[model samples]
Target: MAEEKFPINIWVNEERYEKLQTAGLADMCEEMLAGLKVIRVYANSAQRDKILQVFPTAKFDSATTKSIELLPREVKDAIFGKVVEKRSIDILEEFLGQY
Candidate 1:
């Protein structure tokens, strides 16, 4: 399928912005160049475990794992009932920690 491009605004350090402009492969340099700041990822235990299987280096807090484990199975089922049809959520992850 053909990919779609959309505009997004972001903020970043001037140096990083210049680097992205130099690389030139990114479709949305302005958006990518922005947010040179840290990007936080949140996930629960079972989800974290699956991600770690693929990304062993991913950093996460133990508290988040515990909290996700505490969520009632029934509640999770209801909230994610329709999402199950998608099979998976390949949510965006920052690549090479690039800003």
Candidate 2:
């Protein structure tokens, strides 16, 4: 069976959106809420496990989209930066590798 994927949402502002567009990743924004753009990066089971291990404060928000929530702003910004640099949403494994 395919593994369940957990989401890590990165909220985008105009500056971040411009960077995403330049990185050719603009189409990755799947949802926009209350004038904010959201890009949901998926994490497979192993990567999700790594994230939980690395960030003890993080938890899955099952009440919503099963997203890995409560991440600090700096961490989210770092993740977003990595996404733009790599021009891909498949960044959880590599990003977690730094921890």
**RMSD, each candidate, Å?**
15.4, 1.9
Candidate 1, 1-99: lDDT as tens digits: 543221111222454345434555233332323444311223434455544454454433345332223223343342232122322222222221221
Q: How close is candidate 2 to the true structure, as a TM-score?
A: 0.83
Give the lDDT of residue 55 in candidate 2.
83
What lDDT score belongs to each candidate, Candidate 1 first? 0.32, 0.84
For model 1, give the RMSD to the true fold.
Answer: 15.4
Q: Tell how far residue 21 is off in model 1, in angstroms.
A: 12
Question: What lDDT would candidate 2 get against the real structure?
Answer: 0.84
Best candidate according to TM-score: 2
Clash pairs for candidate 1: 11-35
